[model samples]
Target: MDYQVNYINPEIKLSNYTGKLFKTEAAFTDHLLVWLISGETKIIQADESFVFGPGSTFLIPRNQLATIINIPKDGLPHKAVAMHLSAERLRAFYNQESIKQKNTVSKIFSFHKHPLLESCLASLIPYFEMQENFPENIASLKITEAITILSAIDKDIGSILANFDEPYKIDLISFMEKNFMFNMSLEKFGYLTGRSLTTFKRDFHKAFSITPQRWLTKKRLELAYYQLTEKNKKPVEVYYETGFENLSHFSFAFKKQFGFSPTTLQKIKTNS
Candidate 1:
């Protein structure tokens, strides 16, 4: 099927959504980006599991296997847009003859904040829903905004080319992905990361804009959703697998995070 972005412009297309966990090794013919609006996805690349959440963006390289994991049951409302840059198109769009011909395939990247990109997504609904004038150009403008933001924010370039790089706050996130299934606790995490509990907690909050407990709570909730919808696992199994103390705690937390009880979500899934 043609991706949604294709209809808007010949250069880019948005793929359709599959509600369940997506486990595929597909290839992208053009440069692609998936804007995840909600829920969480564990994208497995080689030995790495990259956890992508709301407002997260990832790249799919041309002709590569992208094994998507932990597709949320309440499949996140998301949009995937791709662009196949041509020399003519590049010149017309940016008035630049030399847009770098980088072989960016199947790579993962993140943008914590980009106003143009944020604005583009905000306008997506109206741009598509209303039968307004110059929709193509308008959507094109949004795509351009996304491209511009990406160019400005992509840090991989300077680090590799200039050899000057600093650590990102996401190093902790990488550690979490590797150790989430283990008996990981706040104290243990602090110890492993070489910081005192108080300092670690403060730094984590400053970095993610949420307390570590809150972050762990959200992560566990996401894990539970994945287990419930994708794994077809029992509630008891989910509770323990997600590191919850008991069923009561799991149910309470699940309800709070998803606005529906686990049983209710299961029933809906079964019926559908």
Candidate 2:
């Protein structure tokens, strides 16, 4: 896949992709507002998966791990406008407005074809080509406008936008078991679990009685084996989803752990 990004500013961008499906694992520091203009996108979180098509608008809160797949639809390229609502910007807006905080445990919020939001995001497309001349003040206003629209739509949005709290130390074992499918660095995993790198390693060892890397690899391979054998999934389909970066590495690790390649397991299952 050929991917391109046109920046309206540091925080706002137009993303375009032409070709086959592209997948990426990401954990954003700021909330993301995406307005899909064409094609389709699937976002997989630890607990759930969401799919969005053209004219879909969705919000991904900060400090979350997700695997995103972008696919071109029909003959057109996958295209979307994305805006980042930075904590700095949110602080200013919330402080000025004194928005009341509401507690929420929601993961992702989706709005389909909302006229006001669609218009707000659509108005920014022209600015992508004139990024050099785009005024910072206008960009700020656009962000503020988006936040206002979101607040109007969902009164409790302050729980996500107005409040900015770093991840607090949580149950490492439970977090790891639920989220190990994502391909993120150990440091990132530590941060999300509210630990420093050293603390993460120490706590992980205490909990699992094994190093984090070894534990993660073993768990991912085990899941891959089950998917290949019981789910009848192909190696190519299983590798990325099971947290390996590539098929070669997944095959090598699977063989090392199970004494057979993933494809070999599939062949055996098929022959039986």
Local accuracy by lDDT, each model: 0.57, 0.90
Q: What residue runs in model 2 are displaced by over 4 Å at the alpha carbon?
A: none
> Which tens-of-lDDT digit does each residue in 59-94 have in candidate 1?
554333344543443544334444443334334554
TM agreement with the true structure for every prediction: 0.44, 0.95
Q: Per-residue CA lDDT of candidate 2, range 140-209, in tens?
A: 9999999989989987788778777899999998899999999999999999999999999999999999
Which residue pairs in model 1 clash with each other?
4-14, 5-12, 5-13, 5-14, 6-13, 61-105, 61-106
Best by lDDT: 2
What residue pairs clash in candidate 2, if any at all? none
Q: Which of the numbered candidates is closest to the native, going by highest TM-score?
A: 2
